[model samples]
Target: MLNTGQNLRPGSQLFSSVSESNHAKGKYYLGNQQDGNLVIYPAGTIDADSSYWSTGTSNRGLLLTLSLDPNGTLWMFDGNTSFTKTLFLTNQSSGAAPAVENYYCLTLDADGVLRLYSHVFLRLEGKPTIKVAWQVPGDRCLVKGVCGPNSFCQLTMTGETSCSCLPGFEFLSTNQSTLGCWRTLPISGCVRSNNSSNEETRMMATMVEVKNTTWPENPYDALPVTTSIEDCKLLCLSDCACQISMFSDSYCSKQMVPIRYGRISGSNNTLFVKVYTYRAIQRKKIAGAGAMLISGATLVVLSLVVLSGSVFLICRHKRSLRYMRAPQLYDCKVDGDIGLQSYSFQDLDVATNGFTQELGRGAYGTVFKGVLANISKEIAVKRLEKMAEEGEREFHREVRAIARTHHRNLLHLLGFCKESMCHLLGYDYMPNGSLANILFNSDVRPSWSKRVAIALDVARGLHYLHEEIQNPIIHCDIKPENILIDRSGIAKIADFGLAKLLIGNQTNTLTGIRGTRGYLAPEWSKNTAITVKVDVYSYGIMLLEIISCKRSMELKRAGSEYNISEWAYECVMFGETKKVADDACIEEAELVRMLKVGIWCTQNMPVMRPAMKSVVMMMEGSKEVRQPPRPASFSQS
Candidate 1:
């Protein structure tokens, strides 16, 4: 029953009878009082009454003429050239044809009744039906002008307004113009409440729950429900500089700085302390009393074990250290002098759960999935299958080399484990498996753009290793199996066991062949001096594979040989480059650009090959492509 100005439309009629209470009728005008003009209707008699005239020509439609009575009877001047009305059951305008007009006026009375008036015609029948509705003009806010306390205002469709607190706050008052809200005090300054005793305050403060809050910056700082108040308090108390403690039944969070925008839920029952006294003596007394009896017996046993083990371990370690520290007599047995953090065998065993989950098997060792116990972070554990001399040398070399290097595109070494017959190296796990899985698997084929991205990622990673680093490293074994993909479809180079670090312009003196077949540089086959170009050639082949989405080698017949790189070379020379491209990458300009780079990298002469730096630049830079020259035996097949 609110008198909202709604549901009123122009061109409506209202009627009243003579029997209506306190009816006063002679001549009454039905028009807006706010306007000076009024239309008169005669109510008492049908005559040319001068009292109804208000200084206007009658022919121009009397501005104040009235000829209707409250008895539902009509009255008007009856003449040939004058306005006239006849008594009828209904009060209807009867006169010369009226001109069509658009203007109308409507008004509401004290009782919320609407009355309408139109210039063209006025008609009223028996008990005219009337309906009312409501409407809003524009948006409104709960706060008159400004927003809530320390809050901003927003308008609703119906013109209603509301408030929102700024960053690092909760709504403290409905009247937002005054004080807004307070932040939880820091743990270093936690104090007992002055309002009431701890017990009474805990009950009241717990009940005064903050409701419907959100942390604008770090949501993790929101108190979780899994942890207890005591546990939450202990966590906050342990960190002397903590600023806030949020706890739920399931979790607890402590912040070291001012808590940001967080809504207090209605159900929160945790206490927020500003600071508390450090009772170290009481804590020490409790700990000392509990451990006194057990400490003696445990210490006695531990001493005897330590005394015996220490002597034996000292001698064994001294011998092993001497052997490892000795000068290397062969190039293959090169010892990397990189100092890395060593992990205890027990630490790694606990991480991998005794190497239970086998991730993959390789010639050197079986890779297993492990978790770092201290951080609770997952990692890949490659446990080397102990062989005579080569495997042990490679294991030590890989750990030392990889641990010394750090790059975004390179896999990270989390830690390592060395046992009598098994050596394990922990690395960050790649969830999406390897590039081989993505390329060859029938279940999922990477889109052309994704393949181009993968190729660029791999190329950039190799370029970093080969050129960007102060001491460039050569990834001796670059192949599809070693190229791992992360969950986001990013490619990273792995398997640094055969990798060698180049200090200055020193070339890696290879004593034996070390690389995958079909991917080995042509110079490596001819016993040419190995350099970073070998890795570049291998990377080029891999790039071609990524662009083509095909294996380096495929069977043409039972006894025939077909190599993808060779076929691609033929296709390029014969001007049928599209035919050699991966069927999946067809019509993709990026793939074509990558293919051009790949061909340039795989040129027969090592010196003619672009440096990995140039390769990366060409892949990323928007430069024009150049036509490559046809080599001898371009289509040997």
Candidate 2:
């Protein structure tokens, strides 16, 4: 069942076996049931136990298909139906679904889990970069009976699990504890019976208390009547079968042999275990007490000597530390819009599999697919080609600003990794990837409606960055490659590497030709103050590409060389507006209106460019947009 893009059509199913990472061993299927609920179950399932997971997508006569987008989005959609779904394997993959489903996978691990993995499959380049987008039992604790009975399991934030034995008990083995713990001290010879005539057989026992520890368990035996700590201790001590006694808020839980235990990281409960004292155990050998005392003193003196020598040697040894990057690092909330998950270089290494799979390449660096193990979250890790301290400072500033942004249209900064000469950034993976992929590479062309929708989504996000935030952000490079789409068909602003943040009320200017060649604003070429209008101009170019599905680099007509903006204007006026657009079903009025806005955004004068806010309203048909004069372009004539 190595399905690349299997369409689980409405009323059909996608099945997988209970073993292996491939569906060949699968007994499970993600089905669109009659009740509108898409469920994962074994074949011939009629009950709840047959299901592993489900999507509640039910309609009387709705049609939908389960697909994985190019950027690793697992989606269920019909574009024409209410049954459309936008599901993410990881929040990083929270962008527009593919225009048409592409390469991705559904893996059924032998560990009894169903997961969705997506790969950016480039047939020509022959690079298949796979990423785990979504998975089941994401939490290690959620696994059934992961720790053996009678042992408490502790789950770390790094996705590692540890098992521990209770006091007076030891694990059956160091590696596995599925069989539970074995008792260290037996109570049969410790507690005395009144009917037993032999007084020498009686032994005194001591209770060892473990503090701030709790195990979550379905108590097979409990004593609600034990209103005090002493009562709970007495109840357990009276019964030799009780291995551990837990007391919390006057409630007592006694676990017998083969206990089911799990450790809560921040618990306040206490577990007390009764064990026979050394004096009690040696009662039968009282005649040799003097000799035993002498031996014990000698052992104590030897132990102190060893402890002192170990500390002296440890102090002389130098230490080197390397952090093991984990998912917990990326879970920090810096501000409202940003969550900075700081990861170790090693974490990124593991996530990207040594950076073997690359999603895309840019002037700054390359981005690869990564998965956070602890939370089972998929993210895109951008590894910079250069890690200068100055660049690192700039990255930090950008992250701070991006984190404060909280809009659906903007790509969020999930986390970052910094170490000696290595700098990486983590972002929610966008399945649709960049707009360039849609307009240039893929055959799954976006319809006129989808193009318009994407234009509006990008507008809204840019509007937030330019107008809503405290400090206006000037995106020096705003192009199709910088615009990312989520599974929901909404677009978002991404790639802040060249983003410039305005400080206070002062208008600060920058130098140098910054953006991609074709989309760079004229102002960038001129020695003048850069403004948010630069982004406005680039966006206009991108908007046109969305409509025409062509690069806006250069266009010529009537044997005269001119820019795309000027060429588009001439075509629209001659009643050839349809010819100016890519082949798609679109109403004449909408096409004309969209074209007019694109023209207005590309106006030669910076003052003529409408703000992103205005762009959004015009695209959404919420504001009246007037027709503009032909946009002037840089002609070589």
Candidate 3:
């Protein structure tokens, strides 16, 4: 196995061994054998069942060595010669490659999974941060023999895979559960017997029903009876040889031990496992007796307490009835799981300190910076000035959509307040303010690297809204003023007042001209149906602004007036792309790549522009950015 301090170099071989580390001993091994193949296996054994992943370079009958590059590329070469043949490779593409000082190594983790890890030294933290650069069988549950036979693999709420034994079964090795499990009680109903003594013992066996679970092992008997789930459960319980029964769509299958390939499934499959019921019966009897004793004592106490509180209860009921009969104030449809709190107008008024400290103003509302009295945490409260234009339903429809969205790059909606016609929204305060403040109004300009990161941040946020969610959202407005920077220097997309959600099977909507003039797509002026590409066009315009640190409409060079998109096209055409973002420290290739992406996005036609997903890939250097065609002379509609 590879060690913590060592990285696999060219012509090096890895042997299976136990090392002192945080991992459990004797569960994993990585071997770059004499053959060309590089494989991972369960420690102490090498078999079809124990092996999980390999480079698939084996069977070539040539000696191969594994090597990891600084860019997180893993490849194998044949023999130790200048003219070496490459066999297998995997690449991890990111914004930039890791530094030479960073430690990169491949390890067969304790969980029987293979991973390429990079330990980069953080200068400010004075310690190295470990990151997983690559991994095989990305879903850990897919690793063969990870949980072994008679046990199921499950993904917990925390996103980790765990092994769980079937009902009435226990782990064979508690310390290392991957070894599998065994039945706690001896098998009794394997063979049918007519003896009366055995009949009662068989009746004692009960079926434990579980939903959304499957054991894909071949069944000894498959019954295609179109019966209900209850009937299937009873059939498995009465069978002499059946250990587990799987039922789906009225089909029943009987499986014998040891059952293999059990996992939590998304389908509506029910698993019924036969378990020893003696212990369960005893526990239920004890619990029932205790419940009866407690109920008898509680009843006497409740009788006395009720007599004393009768008068108080009547008075409280009358008071509540009077309040319930009073006039209703407001009504707003809200989803319980939207992750937004419904605050009264009075509460927001107090939270914003009577709307005194103005943070900023937008097309829909004015934002105020305030510290919540209850939590003593700062918040940005936007009091919608034009709430009267759009009724309560429209305001809440936007709120519900915004609250349902969650991404690291997207702004989080904390809560909302509605009082009759008054409407307001609360958000986590962004201490660094909007991108407009940092770009045009600040004394010091941000570095090229930070600008590139911010552009990517906005692209990812837009991608989440456009493609990642169930109902795609078009952020009609994409501008610097709407992109806010948090305290940690991360940019978040905000202001969803003009955001439009495409309902089921609805790709485009006919809406009036929306968004700032310079950022709007040509479709807006043409009075055509609006799609997500409009946001892409706006993002493209903003991308150029982020690179040049200049506004789109106000861009000029050496006293010559030019649109920012037009100026960028001219720079790229004349082999002067360096002028777009002239930073001495940044790579020219990355700079040119971003310029091309921006140009492609700003194409006049909606179909000509690349989607946000493609833009993000090109900006992150994962996808090659080809040369873009010339944008229309009129960049904005």
Q: lDDT tens string, model 1, 364-478?
A: 5688888886788888877655343444455565556567665556777766655554556778899988888888875767787787787777776776676433345766778
Q: How would you order the candidates by TM-score, starting with the best? A: 3, 2, 1
lDDT of each: 0.52, 0.66, 0.73
User: Candidate 2 or 3, higher lDDT?
Assistant: 3
**Model 3 Cα lDDT, one tens digit per residue, 462-509:** 977875554567778889999999999999999853444212212455
**RMSD of model 1, in Å?**
30.3
Q: Per-residue CA lDDT of candidate 2, range 1-637, in tens? A: 3365465665565555544534464434556654456665434332333244566565445566777654556777765756567776444444645432345677655443567776665555566777666787565444334455555766777867666776767777766664456666433322552323324444556567877655654343788764688878777777755656888877888854444435544667877777663322333343587988988999999999999999877765423113434332333234422345677888889988888888988766788998888889888888776433444445566667666566678887788776756667888988878888887889877787788888888887887677544456777778888788777767888775333422221135556556688787787767777788888889988888788887876555576555877767877888788877746568888888888888988988675577776787678776666656688765322
- Quick one: best TM-score, which candidate? 3
- lDDT rank order: 3, 2, 1
